[model samples]
Target: MRFSVMDLKVGDRTGSDVFNWNGLLVVSANTVLNADDIDKLQRHDIDYVDIMLRYDGKSPEEKPAAAIPQENETARTYEEAVGGIKLLFQQMLQEGKISKELVDQSFAPLANHIEQEKDVVSLLLTLNNKDDYTYQHSVQVGMISYYIAKWMGKSEEEAVFVGKAGYLHDIGKSRIDNNLLQKPGRLTADEFSQVKRHTEYGYEMIMKSQLPEPIALVALQHHERLDGSGYPNALRSQDIHPFSKIVAVADIYSAMISNRVYQQKQDLLRVLKELHQLSFGKLDAKITQVFIRHMIPNFIGKKVLLNTGESGIIIMTHPTDFFRPLIQINNQFINLSDHHELEIQEIYMR
Candidate 1:
């Protein structure tokens, strides 16, 4: 079975050779992991691996299953959600339709779990895996959309519904050609146009299925922007559905921070900055601000590396200066809002 590096204990044995994102070997097949091995895997940002078995006290035959560390339970849940989405996507491509029952099974667990899990920063680390970017992106967008809805004062039921919308936003892509979806190189002009049709494809698919109108609209209009620069249909602010706007914000944030075949993952803080910039004309300002406002506070105790090659703990965040926070190095305090020359090069959410 596949286990997240976060979930693997010291005694767990790898079922296959483990490699980092750059394809460098980190661990050999069937290697019995120690504390350092686990730490090295975490440092390498290796998300998951195939585990043959685990070694407990008595003997390998009598060994019990590993107990998930409380800290890593969320990552385990994320892995399950990713698997569910992969199954659902495969079913859609084969069947040419969505199953509401399958959608609930795949997405509901993660959505319910994330609401209780307050460590939003850590989610950025564990919820992502480059191998299955599409499935992982769907889960992230759904979770983020739910948070945006709740933060914006929507009722609980309403928020969950909006989340379902976000979860299915890309279901249309299931009907698209497999070659185009997996292409690593630049997409041709006509290929890009065909890709854009996923919006209409998703809308039609959902409408034909048992899901509601709002979810269908989200699939169709998640790409639409406030300034009418989006695809499928050039929908201005009012013409776009409110739920779609929430999904749009979630979609952009998830896509930017995710590691994909064609695009490398951007720094989390830098992606937030880009979102803030997009809020002006491309995205809905209120919804984007709500997401950013709630997300920036998660950096309070995070470790950050500065552009000057120094590292510090984020002690406090500035209200006016969203990205730059008050960082503490030993007993010295650096207020990044005041030091405009210094910049946060990276934020260590994990």
Candidate 2:
């Protein structure tokens, strides 16, 4: 059976294959799709459906001839893990309590899910609109930290700890004034000052709870840049905690790509450009290199509409500059890196 965009709604019944649509996926009947699934569909030229479609009643017993159990397993793992994270974030925001029981219940499953699937970035991206950016940002930072630890070849225990650190990196923001948090325009100096208090607020919040001191430290130092340009405390490179450094990279990358009230969402290449520009001063050069070299390449294969109103698939990426990747438009290789006249104006993920 074929479905159109009109047939899908926020809560509608969908088949397992409902997510296979070529554009604008409507919510599945009951199953929630994640950012990874959305990214996969976009990479394959499918659009609209950003997450999994949930179905009602009994699940279909009939399976596709080409069904890959591994993919389904991975998808389910991500859904459960992300769902738990969302619940915890909401609970914390409302109740202002980090229950040890909740942490204990979710940690193993999330850790296992990460271990089973090596791609944490995809998982985080798939969770894009699962909730507000504040909550999702926390999860994304956690996932990114998990991946960074793994990429750096850290042990599983260390990786999980790092992930936990990321999960709480912005817990301080919870105490900030809502007006400041959700302001759509440029923040006044006083508003900005209020916003900056999140780090300290988060540190105090975590310290009051059962969370370890290291986790609190990570949250406190997340804003502290390598060159001592950060806030609360202008700790330099060597002074910043390693976990905090990891969270800083993840936080910045996620924030850049995320759609915000004052700032439009940036393409992967543009985000990487910003990271590369800030590498020495604001971010760690070595980690930024790894992120650009290994992480950013995955999103390049999809088709994108340039700011110039031209469209094409990303054909090649420059080693030093990601924003100038070559695009294959109408069978022509447009080398954006070498041609200063041409730049990707914007990315329209198909």
Best candidate (score: lDDT): 1
Cα lDDT of model 1 by residue, 1-350, tens digit: 99988888767878987766544455657666766567667755789989998766667543432333444667777778788878877877777777888888877887777775544665776556547777888888888899899878888789999988998899898888878988989999999999999999889888877689999999999999999999789999989999999999999999988877688887687799999999999999999887886676556567888889988888666657767778998799999889999988777753
Instruction: Report, for every candidate in turn, its global Cα lDDT versus the true structure.
Output: 0.80, 0.66
TM agreement with the true structure for every prediction: 0.77, 0.73
- Candidate 1 clash pair list: none
- Worst window of 10 by summed lDDT in candidate 1: 62-71
Report the number of the highest-TM-score candidate.
1
